[model samples]
Target chain A: MQASMSCRPKWGICKMNQDLIQYLLRLGDSALIQGQRLCEWCGRAPALEEELALMNVGLDLVGQARNWLEYAAELANDGRDADHLAFRRDERAYRNLLLVEQPNGDFAVTVLKQFFYDAWHLAVLEGLTHSSDSRLQGIAAKAVKEVTYHLRRSSEWVERLGDGTEESHQRMLAAIPQLWRFTVELSDSDAVEQRLHAAGLIGDPQQIAAAWQQQVERTFDSATLPLPAPACHFYLSGRQGLHSEHLGLLLAEMQFLPRAYPDATW
Target chain B: MQPGDLIASDLGARAAAPGDLDQAWQVLGRVMDPEVPVVSVVELGIVRALAWDAGHLHVVVTPTYSGCPATEVIEADIRQALEDAGFRAPQLERQLHPAWTTDWITSTGRERLLAYGIAPPLGSANKRSLLGDNGSVNCPQCGSAHTELLSQFGSTACKALYRCCDCREPFDYFKCI
Candidate 1:
């Protein structure tokens, strides 16, 4: 990481290439974490259609994560596959944004969190399509299409929940502030992100932030829900592997069978 | 479960190979989709590639839908089929880029799908407009273009619930992405 510290002015290609694994992890971790959270609702969603939809969204994220982590493993050249990258890591080693790993509280909370994440996901993925790295470009080109549908579904739910009923409105409003702070860390670029930007491996997070804000505001207006106050000290950035207590519990469950069974394939 | 082979140490090394890809493809052709038993994975176009690496057979597979539950089952079936056909350990690589769109569904695959009572996806994946969910869909049961989507989601992740006007029967519409 010391080599990575010397990044800002002009990043060393070798060092930036090394940081590429971490960059991929940051992206992959978010998807993997969200997928794990959503997969928990496989049989528990309120309705059958909703259940399949939730599981599908989770699957899409996991699929994206598998692509990213597989690429990351290739970049690291360490021979580990995506599954190892996903289930083998400890909780503290994960680099997902704080937003995704937040527990799926109520149905409203889950939908709102997804909407928030998808909003940022779209902004970032669209910019990523033009990455100088052909691998990133290809993945982004494929992923942007998937996330577009994801955002549409989540945004529709936000609108219905926010405008539908007294209970649904309150639940949606309550979940907004609960998860809003996590969105701040999404656009806040860290050192690794800066290096990837310098290398043209990824897009500028600032532009993504601007797009995310515009889209979120438009969505909130239609949802009839007031956006929460901006930036309190609750900045929970999971980028550097720091995460909430909830992550550990989630990991314990997901990694259990994998860790126990090791190389066992289905 | 034997954890030693699955451990991460030599995990990156290519699996042992026989390079028997022709036999592997033949085996794969017989591995049907778990949900739709009539159609094989190859027909579904999910098995993207078969190659030899590190003396082990490597396969590239892309599921029809990202959230399709049968992804795991299909992979297992492919592995088991190849292994049963006397190949050594086969490696499966999942690629999401150039994501699997309905366009990848082969013409033969489309026929198999239609015969299976699920309407096939109508449009190409490239022209994906967000809200255009209501395109004219032919009912597989009646071959009627007059079909109404009852729900955007079906019993499984990759389908939509629809009812046909001509046949007055509820069926699954393999949605165009």
Candidate 2:
């Protein structure tokens, strides 16, 4: 099948290489959206240490986004660089998972969101460590160390919340049900996955799902929160350009300067 | 030789030779933090070593804090600046040892930050001496040592947000670690 029109070559633009850019954006946007959500807790966290740790995780994710977006721009063969790709894209152009765009409800919800995503992120990064794409592999290798710490920190919080005060325990337990629906989407399969998997740029989502389930199950068990049933068909269109209403608002705030003043520099 | 002439003659070879230190320091001052983009990494104390090795310039930098987001971009900007100035591919060596401390932020950087409207970090000695073991950071703007830490985490992980009683300006304090 021919590449989509959005992926096609345009006047004054280099040869279209949308698949690679889209794939790279998928990674960058995931980190970007999740990092924004994490940043919301900057001034408000359960405790001082926890606050720093969460902020560190957010920084790591945004750092990862910068690296991946830079590579995406390079692959696009367009003159656009990391800043342009990150700040110039329309809402419909982003391919981040819907779960990342979900607002941070509370401390417990925030930890749950992080725990859910970190578990999947580490698994995917581990797989991508040996990708055929050199740039992707290098970024994943550098990010794996950071994400490992993220997983450890979030997992500790999960257990602490699960075993903490009665109020904390109940709040954390309630967070699980609302957050579980998002996990199904993380390992959801799609045509893009098929192409990338064939190209050896990604691993099988089914395998990733199986591994992620085992990992999260053990962490939840330690957290004392029972695993909730997965949604059969969670928000599935995010990777294909469809997203929740919150995503556009996020892009607007994130891309405001670039949109307002084109080619503006620091 | 007289005492002064003997001292000068002996010091001529021993004096630290002025190399690209001045130029590198100036260029680094222009290289801002990749994420924040307001503060210079040199002022942030992330630049460890700047030397002229053979014909190429070598710069060694460590992260401001462990896994700080600006390290990668800082390295990139360093390379870009040197190349733009007609230097060869600059050698950027990563050194994790002697981890960066907010205490190392040059006085110039602190002044620049204040002039830019963002409060500078309290000197490490002042904070360590004042807070005892609790590690309280005083506000830079109002000289109000009585400040409460809003979050151990600031807008970014490398900083902590504190509010002052005198001015009530919420500012990001560069964490000592």
Q: Would you list the C-alpha lDDT of every candidate in the order shown?
A: 0.80, 0.72
Off by over 4 Å in 2: A1-17, A234-236, B1-177
Hey, what RMSD does candidate 2 come out at? 11.3
**Which 10-residue window in model 2 chain A sums to the lowest lDDT?**
A11-20
Per-residue lDDT over B1-177 for candidate 2, one digit per residue giving the tens place of the 0 to 100 score:
223334334434222233757876887788898765777878777888888875567789876543465567778888776555544556788764443455788888777766665556554633232222345556777767788866555676655577887788888766543
DockQ values for all predictions? 0.35, 0.12
* Residue A91 CA displacement from its true place in model 1, Å: 2.6
**lDDT of candidate 1 over B15-90, digit per residue (tens):** 3346456777888989998988887888888999988886567899986665466788888888777666655666
Docking class of 2: incorrect
